[model samples]
Structure formats: structure tokens, C-alpha cells
Target: MLSAAATPAQLSAQAASGEAGLERSERAAEEQQADNIIVTGRAQKLYRVETTASTKLPTEPLLSSQNVSVITSELIQDQGARDAQDIYRNISGVSFFSYAGVTARGFRQEEIFFDGLRGDPYAGFSVPQLFNLDRVEFLKGPSGMLYGPGAPGGLFNYVTKKPQDKPFSADVRGIVGNADRIGGSAEVNSSLGGGFAARGGLFYEDRGLFRFNAASRTLIADGGVSWSPGPVTVILQATRYDQELDASRLRGVPTDDDGNFLADRRWNHNEPGDFLNLRSDVLQARIEAEPLPGLTLDATMRYNDATEVQNYHEPRGLFDSDGDGIRDATIREFRDQRRDEESWSFGGNAVYAFDLGGDVGNRVLAGFDHFNGEEIFAGRSLRGRNRVVAGLPSPLSLLDPVYGQSDPATYNQGPFSIFNTDSRRTGFYLLNELTVGPVIITGGIRQDNFHDDSDGIVFEDEATTYRGGIVYRVTDEISLFGHYATSFEPQDPSVQNPLAGGPFAPTAGDIFEGGIKTALMGGRIQSSLSAYQIRRRNILQVDPRGDVGNDGVDDFVAFGEVTSKGIEFDLAADITPDWVLTVAYAHNDTKITGDNGGGGILNRVGDRFANAPKHQLGIWTRYQIPDIGIAAAFGGDYVSEQVSLSGQPVRPFMIFDTSLIYEVGPIRAMLRVDNLFDKTYAVSGFIDRTGHFPGEPRSIFLEVGYAF
Candidate 1:
């Protein structure tokens, strides 16, 4: 831990995390239970957290220069959040872009972190499971200095549940809803004595969507064991996750120019046979030792294997063969994709805390990480990552859709390349934090070396990023911080067209940010006010040259620059010990500022990023009356209008949700209702050329659980 003055964030979480917090939590079950619906106190912090998931020096969040937003396990349970999308409303400046994809800080983000690992175990389109996880942390801005190549908009880091060295504790839950929702889960954690502990969980759910012919089923099995002896600790864990999206890739309903659905709200073009599936297995091991009084060493390793399969329909467009102004028919293409991916990652870091003299201290961290990954992808159609083989397209009526008109067996499956590619990276990083009196200064640097091979075509590259920041303790209740950071990302080797600046420079981004954190109302309310400007260079866009093949789709190029500037405010408070509230607001403006060559008004200067709203707000509040074992939670999310890639308008929308809870002894129950007004809205505007993704109209789910 770095030597620094105490801040409000630290004061709020000093009693809620790690080993020391565990001991404090056991005695404050009734107090923390105000946020934890399970009643039994979970060691991990619920509403407030003190530190980030750092392998280096640990510092309080408010004092840290980076901007990070967290979603604790307690928040997930209180909202009855079923998946990743459900919790997006709790964070500011986050909106849906596509399947398992989000627009964060005006950039479409896809990559994520599992624990301290940089790679995602699940496939791109696969939705992540939340049951086996402890919390989600969003780190904003360029992180290349710490994690490796990625988008500048930032990434999500998920912390998994670990074995707790305490008395035996178990929880079981069952859920039911109106829309074919039936789910259950069981979890157990216990101390095996002799410095040994174990934890395990099983979760299964089968749920239907608001749209017709769309549904999902998921199963997850996870377990872990840890042994702590003297000054050393070792942990081993394994997880298996399986999910099936039936009648999958339900992009959206066919809509007219005015955003009115030409078909029913629940319309779906896919047949019952179409599906998207994913299966992943992962193993992880770690060891930590404190051999000296002020020195710590940690090492971790992970092995992951995952397979994803997709069989879905892609809507070509609605057309009137007769050239009539009114279109009634649509063209559909069948797509088949299968991929198997594997990766191995190893990392080690050491931190040493020493004092320059009295009242002054410094902590230095040095680490190295290596990753090796391989992928095998196969597709039946040339459109989806295939070296050869072309598929056929079928037609359907927009007014009266017919199913089972297309078959994958008819497509030519010959001469397809399944040996996709192999990639590797190695990173060496260092960080230093120096504390002098009331001021702290920090700096970090990382050098990443990348090697990739696609079908024997090999490419090697390297990038070095840097970060510097300062935090000044003005008073015990307020702190001011500022930072400047730079990030880098490697481009896809396949997009090497000369017209679009093929073999172009890799993407680079930078940010200048400042913030003030304050503790008000006698340290009960904590708030942060911040502003930042982020710029992305070497962004991929449409090529100025017309489509040589006249495929009606413009080609892609890499010669664009974008800038996003935003102001955000967040507040979390414990109002009177029985009530808690969190509020978030953001205003972001993203524009295409530079373009070398552009045509047809696409990817041109001044164009806004698609599906990114300029304004967003979220509020959540929970209150409990301890005397009666009853509590209530109410929350809502608001997002402004946005422009789609096709130059269509995505209207603004607001949704409100509420939950009613009843707890007595070890039994707990909750009734959650989402979209209370059944408003008609779109989750994504013009997500594709011919449709807009419809939002869930209304939903109600009931949960019952027992814990001891």
C-alpha cells in the first residue's frame, strides 16, 4: 500500500475489503445488510470499495488519477440484474452498441479483463455470466500502459469470488417470471481448517425474451481453493461456462423512416433451428508472499479454452422488385460460423514500500506479463472470415414472414480455411508513487511487443505508453487530482488495402483529465466531479474509393481521427444509515475531426459516432426499515438521442425500475419490475441497415433465497 493521506473513499471502504475487512464485516452484518440483500454479510465490499484491482501499488480510488466506476455484487443483487446489459443503466456514459458490445466514453469497446488478465474468456458475441463474479470495474481512458493493446475508451475488469477463510456459509436462490423465466443457483464457501478454504457455485437459467422466437439458456460451474500458511498464500480455481442463444442474432424489427415498426414489435426473421452457442473452460493459479516486512511478491497463471458456434440469419434489406414506393419483401442470408480459441497467460509483479525519510515514503512496482493465443475459425459463407466458398440468399416477406425457407446444407462448404491465426504479446511495466507531506506524484510506463501470424504471414510490432499524474490533499475531506495518459492498439492485418491506407499506422489515443473528490455532510456523502478530452488517431473508416465490386457496401479504410470530450459527476451517499443513494450524470460530445479522404458523406469530418448519446443520467436509491424486515429500491436511466451509422435518428428514452424486498431471518425475497411504464423504445437505433433494435417493453421477476 502506498503511503498517502486518508480520503473519503478510503474512509467509506476501509472496513469492507480483503482480510482486514472480513474481520470487521463479521461483526457488522446488520449494518452492511442494508445494501446486501442476502442478509449474510459477504466479505467483499458492496456499495463502496476502497481500492482498484491492481497488481502493483494499492491506492485509494478517490486519490488515484485514473477514473474508475464500480458495480459491486450487492448492487447487482439488489437490482435483480440478470446479465451484463441489465447493469449498464447503473453506470454513466455507457450504452448498447451490439451483442455484448458497449459504447463507452464515445468509443465502441469490445475487449475486457477477467481478474487481472487482459483477455476475455468468452467469444466476442457471447454474453458474460454474472453469477460467479464478485464485481465489475470500469476503468476509463487509455490503459495500454498497464494492460496491453486495446481501445482508448477503456475496458471492464471483472473480479471473481474467492474462497473465504470463515465459518461455513451457503446460499440458494430460485427465480420465476412471466416471460418463461425460471432460474436457480446454489453457492457454498467454508473453511477446511489448517489454513485451507474452498468455494463453489452452480447456476442455471432458461429465460425468454420479449421478442418472439428469441430466448437464452445459460449454465455455469465454478470452484476454487486456497491455502494460507505463515506469510505465503496459494490459490487454484477452475470455471466452466455454457450458453445458447436460440433463434439468435435477432437484430431488430423492420422499421420505417419514422422509427415505426413496419412489422410487429416481437417480429423475428430467424427460424427455430437458428442458434448461437458458446462453451468456455478456464483454469487459474496464483501465489502471493510477503517475505519481508515491506516487500511483496505475487505470481499468477491462466489457461483458457473456448468454442463458439453461430447459425443465424442476416437481413439483406426490404425491396419492391417492381420499384414501388412501398416495400413488402425482404432478402435474408444464412450464416454459419464456428471457432475454437485457446490462450495461456503468465504474470508476476513485485512491490517494495520504503521511506525516503521521516514523513516521506515511496512505493515502486515492477512487473512482466506474457500471453500466447491461438484461434481456429470456420465459416460456410465467404462473407464471414472465409478464404473461399460462397453461400446463397433467401427471401422473406416483411408483412407475413415465413420460416424454414433456408438451409445451411445447401451452401457450398468446400475449400474453407479453418486454421485462422496465432498471436502473442509480452509486456514489461513499472510504476512509482512518491508521497511527500500532503502531495503525491505517480508515473507508469509499459513496453508491449506483439507478434501475429495469419496463415504463415507474420508481423511483429512494439509500442510503449506512458502515464503521469498528481494528487494533492487539500484537506481530510477533499482531494484534487489530474493526469495525462497515452495508449496504443494494433490494427487488423487483413485490412491492408492501399486505397484505405492499408498497412497504416496503429491506432493511438491520449487523454488529459482532472477531477476533484469531496466528502460532504459529515463524511456521509462522497462525490467526484471530473472532465476529460480524449482523442483517437488512425481510426478505421470508409475508403474514399467507390466499391470496386459494386457490392453496394463501401470499403473500409484507416485514415480517420476522432475526439471525445466529456464532463461527468458521480455521487454516492449513506443518508441516515437506513437509506443509500447513488447518482451519475455525463455529457459527452464525440466528433470525427480528421479525415484524409472521404466519399458519400460517410466517415466524413464532423460526423458523430453512431449510437453514442450526448447526455446520460442514472439514479438508484435503496432504503430499509430494520424494524420490519422490509426494504424498497427505485432507480431509473435516461439517455439522449443519437445518430445511427446509416444517418438515421435514434430517439431518446428513459426507463424506471423498482424492487420490493422482504427479509426475515435467513430467508429473503424480492420482486423486481423493469420498465415500469411499458414505454415503446429502441435499445439501439438503426443498429443495422434495415432495422432498429427494440427495447424490452415491461418485465417482472420474483426471487427467493435462503442464506446461513
Candidate 2:
């Protein structure tokens, strides 16, 4: 049953989980600095993040009045995190919809940015390689006041590794893990002459999945050059990534009538020849100048090109046509799809600081950004060739399994039809921060114009959003803050209301949040508690009164509303010289408050949103024995039950992970095990009962690295 509030036990369970991980990381960073040991660039610290450039201006987390989580390179290496999904365990109220799509606060986050610039949609869908990244930042809540149009769930930003102006240094790492995982990466950083420096990295991996006939091979190369001439500095960065997957993990396993998963945990239903390939290229240039004292100007431009090709035989689930107790046959569907996207963006910002006499200061920031994107998609569904592998009286028998019998080439027939789309957006914003004694006030406003054209239909929309916040320092160690923000997201041009004969209007969202942040024990411990409520209007819903066209197009109306409210608690502490702990918990309750006479987009009013768990908890603790050069870490994650869009209940699950680390001189070794208990669960799923995504089984990975 759905509830409006979380139970005391649910809240406490999540709170305990969140604090352990936060404290461990904070303590580790402090100890490393105290011992004068440099690790991964510049000693990744979690107790205090003093500045974040992603928020349009460098701002401290405590003063910003928004919840932000920073996953540093040190943490990534410690946990052996390879992708975005792997890092989400340390953040609260965040989960994966699939390998690509992420959901926060009950809404899907479709927009992603790289180094403060808009990212290509297609490229964002692929699994990102973290070898060349310095850090990953998550800004929770609506962010349209700073960025452009986006989902209200917030966004993710990937910060690239920058060139170093220091002595030449290099690192090489090799990885071997279960499921046939083998990979290696190399990075080099050096300083040229005349204040110039360069950094380059190469990464390659070939891995097999727990399921049969599913594997991936990937290669990535990244390089960047930075030069500082007098007061002006310039940086140029580029990256190329290519990947091939034997089959997509999107096609999940089937479930029986009683919502029980039918296939084995390691079962894969795709044909042997099914595969997906992706190629992406990105180039970015940034320039920063201080033309006058107390003033700074910066400009950035980025270009991205990506293509994806996929051909797969997807499983459709089992059917008992004759109403017998056992399954009759297995249904399968085939698809041949290709997508290409090219995008470019240009943005600039100027900031000036001045004193307001008598211990007061002010800073003003102004920025403008413009982006253009074009995409082409071609897909063909082999419906006429749908196959039902009959004669297998009971395919669910555990004794023996049959697979790879169907020839996918017979269903590969396709006469591809191309669909083209173009999108353009331009936005400008102004922000100001005023500090007086122990109080800081911040405000910002933005205006955006968005245009989209798809299949010869054009839609243009404009939005104006604003945000305001206040941060008051109650003491040197504690700060209290409150914020309000508004956002708007335009609808896709292809999504139309048959009754209105046009695209629906953009959705609008508003949020109010308040929080308290504290740093204790001489900055060895940091903790925060925040509560927020968000309301989104103009959501689309099916119209029951409207007639359905012969083409199977159903009418829709923009008269639905959704509400998401939650409280999050996070703590990080260095309990002692050798012990560190971190923990985080989030309790989110999301439901559709209003809908048309018919149900909402995927459910009826008052129904909890799909894939949005009410309780989420994580804890990670690490201990080091300096004399013996050994370190160990243990972590666990918990997720409450979630409801599917179709109102099916997904069970709650908890999993544990551990790592052992050993280091001597320039050599380091780590052994990590994920899912130590080998619990079988589903992380996500589709609306229908046909598919359920199963969690990965227990796996072990060992990594070795040498730094010089």
C-alpha cells in the first residue's frame, strides 16, 4: 500500500546507512593530508567542498542552499567504481532507471552536462568511462534557473581531468575480475615550458557479463592542454570513445503471472548475433581572463558527435494461450535501430566582486548560453517475423534450458525509415550574492527560448525561471539555509495530443527546500539534513473521452499534477586517526495529486510513482593500519519496496560490498567484492509484467596500479 509519509523505522534505517560512508571518506582525506600523502590529483576530501564551478560561480556547498554530492576520484578508485551507476550508492535519493537513465526524487533525469556545458543526448545514454574524469557532481532539485530546460529531478555534471603544471607524473593500472572482465588504463601528466602543461589518458576494457552471450569491448582516449599566458588562461580538451556490446541489457528477463521471475538469474534470451555499437567524439575549449582587478571573464565552447547502432532479438515474455498451469511457448521480438546525433554549445560568463563598505561584500555574475542539436533515427520492428518457439512443453523447467536455437538473420529484414529532429536553445541568466556578517543572500533569474522540429512539425516555447536562497551561519561550525526555485521543461515535438492536433505545452515545476549543515570535530565530521517539496504541473494524461485513431494513436491532455516531497540526511566523519565512515539516507514520497477523468500517464491519481523507492540508505566505513600498509572497507546499500507503473510491487532488497587494499611505495593493490551475499533482486523494470531487470550476482575484482 502507498502512504503519504514514511514510517519511523524506514526513516531511521536510511539515516543510519547514510552516515557511515560520509564519515569514512571525510576521515580518510584528513588523515592523508596530515601525513603529507598525495593521492589521485590533490587528496580528495569530502568534509568540505569549498567551491563548485558548476553552479555558474564558485560557491561553497553550505552557502549554496542546495543539496550537492561530490564523488571524488579517490572515492572512485577506492570503491572500484567504473560508471555513473556504480557511484550512486554513496548518494541518497538516486537510482538507475537503466544503464543510461537516472531517476531522482521520482522523476527521470534526461539532461546531463559535461564541464558545465550541455551534453549530447545520445552520448549521455551510453555508459561513460570514468578513467579520464576528475570528479562527478550531482546537483539535486530543479536547476533550470542556472542551466537551461531540464527535468525537475536535477542533473549530473562530469568534470574532466585538467592538465597539471608540475613535475612529470604517470600512472598505469590493470584490472581483472569475474565474468571475464579484463581492462587496463594509462595516464600521463607533465608540464611543458612557458606555463604550458598537458595530460593524456588511454583506457581499454573487454568484459563478459553474468548472462550468456553478453559482452562488451570498449576503447577510450582523452587528452587536454592548458596554457597560462600572463593573466589569461586557455584549455583545450578532446576525447574519443568507441564501444561494442554483444547485446543490450535493456531487454530484461520475463516474469510469471504471480510476478515471480521465471528465468535463472544468469539467463539471457537474446540471440548470439545481437549487438550494439556506439562511437562518440567530443571537443571542448575554455578561456578565462582577468582583464581588470576584481573581475573575471570566462568562455567555453563544446562540440559533440555520436552514433549508435543496435540490432537485437528482444524477449517478450511467456504466454499460456490454453490457460494451462505450465508455460506454452516463448515470445520474441526483433529490432534494427540506428541513431546519430551532432550537437554544439557556446557559453560565457562574467563575474565582478566589490566591497559594500563596513564588512559587507557583494559579487555579481551574468552568463549566456546557446546550443544546437540535430539527430536522425532509423528503426524497424520485425513484427511480421515474430517467433514463438513451440514444442517446448515447459520452458520453465530448472533441470535443462534451451537457448540460441533461433536464427536472428531470418528476422533481420528491414526497410529503415529515417526520422529527423532538430533542437535549439538560448538562455541568459543573472545572479548576485551578498554577504553581511554571518548572513549570505543569493538570487538568480533566467530566461530561455527553446525550439524543436521533428518530422516537419515545429514547436517553439519560452520560459522564465528564478531562484532565491538565504544562508545564515549560526556558528562557525553550523549553517542554516532555505531556497526556492522554479523550472520548465518543453515537451518533445513528436509527442502530441491527437484531440488538440498539436504538441502539448511545457511542464512547469516549483520547489521549496530548507536545510541545516554542520562541521564538527575540527572539520573531521560534516553533516547535513534537508527537507524539500516539489510540485510539477501540466503533466500529460490520456483522455478517455477522446476518440482513438485507426493508427493506434491515443489522445492526451495536459491536466495532470505530481508532487514529490522528501527529507535527506547525510553524515561524514573521521572518527579517529585511522577510522573513517560515511552514511546517507533519503525518504521520498511521490504521487500524482491530480489527473484527468482518466488515469495519469502511467497510473491513476494518488498512486506512487514507479521505480521511486520511498526509503534509500547507504553506509561505507574504512580503516587503515599504517604500520602494515593495509586498508579495509565495508559497505551496504538498502532500497525499500517500489511499485511498478502498472501497480505491481517490487520487493525490497539490501546488498553488501567490501574491499581490501594494500600499498607499498609506488605499487598499490585492491580486491573488491560486490553483492557479497549474492542476493537476487531487480533494480528496475518496464511498466508491464513482461520484463524485470535483475541485479548482478556476486562478483570479484582485483586491481593493481603503479604510480611514478
lDDT of each: 0.75, 0.74
C-alpha TM-score for every candidate: 0.90, 0.91
**In model 2, which runs have C-alpha deviations exceeding 4 angstroms?**
1-48, 121-125, 257-259, 321-323, 384-401, 497-503, 548-554, 602-606
The root-mean-square deviation over C-alpha atoms between each candidate and the true structure, in angstroms, is: 5.4, 5.6
lDDT of 2 by residue, 1-708 (tens): 000011111111111114664774565565553332333211124323456666777766656676677776766777788876787666677876766677788887756788888865346547776788888777788888888788887778888898988889999999999888999999999999898999999999989987667898989899999999999989999999898888663555665534466777666656567788899999999999999988999999999999999877655545554567655445556678888999999999999999999979999999999999988999887532223443211122222345555555555455888999999999999999999988999999999999998987888879999999998877666788899998988876877533354577789988999988766554556777889999888977666766455445667677878899999888776676667777888899888877776775543324777778889888877777766668888888888887655556666888888889887677789998899989898876655524567888898989999999
> Which regions in candidate 1 have their CA more than 4 angstroms from the true location?
1-45, 54-56, 321-324, 382-393, 406-419, 497-502, 521-523, 540-559, 599-606, 686-690
Worst 10 residues of 2 by lDDT: 1-10
In lDDT terms, how accurate is model 1?
0.75
Q: How many backbone clashes are present in model 1?
A: 0
